[model samples]
Each structure stands twice: as structure tokens, then as C-alpha cells.
Target: MSGPIHPPLCRVDQIMEVMQAAFDPAWGEAWNRRQIEDSLAMPNVFVLLVDSSGDLVNADAGASGLAAGFVLARHAPGEEELLLIAVRPEFRRRGIGEALIRQLAQDARARGAERIFLEMRENNPASSLYHKVGFEPIGRRKAYYLFADGTRMDAITFGLSI
Candidate 1:
């Protein structure tokens, strides 16, 4: 089922919690308090999500009010890069992640961006979602992500012209 996804205004803390939980420590590093604080301070940053009953969903409990997923983006000059996108584990296989990406693309276009970009771990489970939404691999970074377990993973950069 489709749900309304909008830019979160006062739910930054909740979003950060969910993001950290959904992101695997073995695949990529999770955002720290300081990083989240900095990102929220930037005007170019946008955090969008499908909140449950106008409340931020929690990542710990399966039924946390902050259910579904989230998408984070930041504008840079001529393009907007999707910095992060995550759906609750129980919410997977649904279209929540795809919807978030689509909304992010639309937001990018609305902001005069000619293209949208994102980087995913080489073996990220969400890679299929990115590809399905028209993102194509345009570049790669060797050992770009340092996981929490001290392992490194290559990053695959994907882009789509809006």
C-alpha cells in the first residue's frame, strides 16, 4: 500500500535512529551523533519519510511509530545526491524504498537539478531498487566504505538524469 512521504521537519533525531539501525555495520559506517547534527545543520540537506500517525517511527521495535522508510539527500551545485535510503527490515519487499527514491528524484527536479546521484555498497541489497528506478552505475570508488567491523567495501556510484 502507498503512504504519504514528506520532508521531516522536527523528526531528525528519530530518523537518525532508524537510519543507524537499518544500515549494517559490516557494509558501511553508521552515522554518528555529530554527523547527524552537522547534516541537519546544512540547508542543502533534506530528510523525507513515511511517518506513522504523524510521529517518527522507531527502529528498535518492529511496531515503532516510525515505520516504513526514509530518504536523505543533499544538493551540490548542479546535482542532488541521495545520501541515504533505508526501509525497516520488516518493511522490505514493499515499494516504500522505491517511492522514497522517486520522491527524491522529483524533489531534485523541482529544485532545478538536472541529475540525481547516489552511491551504494557494491553488494547492497538496495542495489536492485536503485537499478529499477533508472539509476545506472557510472563510477566506482575502491574501498570507499569502512564498515564497523573494520572491513572495507567498494562503492558503486549511480546516476540518473532528470
Candidate 2:
């Protein structure tokens, strides 16, 4: 693989593209533009993204390269919650996700957050990355994610104290 990936700090308007790149339709994890917009409108919401376009030299110039992966999170008093994190299907397994998580943790700590929390479907393979970054299982919400075909999956919650 190439050297470690360098991700850009995404602008608010650029969230949807990176989000779409990072999620799979089959997993039902993709958030629509409206939902993302609404979330971003909330106080203390932040986003981290990787744009691989290779041409991005300025983040404020709207030419910050192409979308690769992203993480959306919310910071409340003393805590930060990772609401969504995704790597484009083509970008998986290359450490983009790990970089995003690591940076998010560091950013949260810098902002005075005491801990970080994230919840995902119990079967999500990305949980391994979380574990590798020092996150530990804190709780589970039984049958929290319901499928379209009448099936359900538990929601696994992980926590990392900074």
C-alpha cells in the first residue's frame, strides 16, 4: 500500500458526497442528503473526510479533491458520539477508516471530551478497527436495528475514555 493516507477536513456542504462514497446501499447505512444536512445544522456536529482527488491544495476552494471516506460525529458536554463512519467500497482495507477514527478520538480529546461512544449493528466488520483503536464494548441494545424483511440486529455500543 502507499504511505499513510492524508484526509482533508471536509466542508459542511461536502458531507453528502463523502458519505455516499463510504456507504453501501445493501447495508442500509447510507444517509440521505437531507438527513446529513439536518444533522450538520445541529450544534457541535463535526465531520472528517478523505478526498483522494489528488488536486486538492485548499480546503476552502471547493476543489478539495475526490471523496474517499468520512466520519460524522456529535459532541455533547464531556462526550463525543460517532454517529456515522464509512469508507468508500473501493477504499476499504487501506487504513482510511482507522485514520478517521484515530483523528476523531484525538480531536474529541482536544476539545475536552472525556470519552467517545459509537454504536453499530452487531455484525459490522468495522468493529475490529474500533477495537484496534482501544475501544471496548460498553453495552448492547437488543434488536435495535430492524431490517426490511422483518429481521433485526442488535446494536453494539463501544466506548473509549480519553
Candidate 3:
């Protein structure tokens, strides 16, 4: 007897596909395949991918469709960290990023997380989205990020209580 086919809960290919199109190379913000694979290997880490329709891509649907956006997060007791989130450049301003964050928040809350935290380089365009989603700047580290051209930027930390 043959067993039923089950799709992977997270697809790295789809994540990479979106990442390549979403992140600017100059920022060096995109994670490599090995980083993503290693993160996903951890028990407390989870990835959520969304399709063009802003629907969750899971085992039951859109298993092979390219992801429009993805969010990766790690959970700790009573808290979760938004490690990375990206949407294809063409998909920006279409609510996909918001959808991903909302879904991640929902999932994090479901996993017993009471708050979420994330850090971004200064002047990141995503600041608006973070603010719109109720994430408040809680702290900052000056010259936290060093670019290839020897430029440095502060890293702002934001937090959201679920």
C-alpha cells in the first residue's frame, strides 16, 4: 500500500525565490540558503509563506507555486522574534507584507508568545509597515550594522505585545 503524499510545512525554495527579488544587495540583509536551512532545523523556529493571493501556503494548497512573501521567526517562552520577513518587489504595497506579519503574530500567539521583537537597520523602508502593525521602537544600537563600503548604521529594535 502507498501512503498519502504530504507536502513540507515549509519550502526553502519558495523563500529563496522571494528573497532574491525582495532584498537589495547593498543592504546585505538577505540570509543565505544555509542560514535558512539551519534556522529551520531548529525546533523553536518556524517559517510562514504566502502566495500571491495572500493565502498561507501549506501542505494542502499551493505546494508548488512560488511564494510571494515569507516570514521566519523564532520562539522563546512568552516571546517570539521576527528574524526575517520579505516580499517580492513586485508584490510590495499590496498588503502581502502586512498579511505575513499578521499571520506570524497569530501563529506566535498560538504558540504561547505574548510579544514579538525585531531589529532593523536605520531608515529601513519597512519602518512604516512595522509602525502600522503596532510595533513600537523600544531601543536602538548605534553603528550596529556595518556595510561593505565601511558605512555604519544604527539598528532599531521594535517590540509588539500580542
Give the candidate order by descending TM-score.
3, 2, 1
Global fold similarity of model 2 (TM-score): 0.84
User: What global local distance difference test value does model 3 have?
Assistant: 0.85
Clashes of each: 2, 1, 0
lDDT by residue for model 3 over 1-162, one digit each (tens)? 011112245788888999989999999999999998888888888887877888777745438877798888988999999999999988889998998888888888888999999999989999999999999999999999999999999999999999
Q: Which ten residues in a row have the lowest lDDT in candidate 1?
A: 1-10
Order of candidate numbers by lDDT, starting with the best: 3, 2, 1
Worst 10 residues of 3 by lDDT: 1-10
Q: Who wins the TM-score comparison? A: 3
What candidate 2 gets wrong by more than 4 Å, as runs, is 1-14, 53-58
**Which residue pairs show collisions in model 1?**
57-65, 57-66
- What is candidate 2's lDDT per residue for 43-111, written digit by digit as tens? 688776665532222354554545677778888989999999877677778877787788788888877
Q: What are the RMSDs of all candidates, in order? A: 5.0, 4.6, 4.7
Give the TM-score of each candidate.
0.80, 0.84, 0.92
Where model 1 places Cα greater than 4 Å from the true spot, the runs are 1-8, 52-64, 148-150
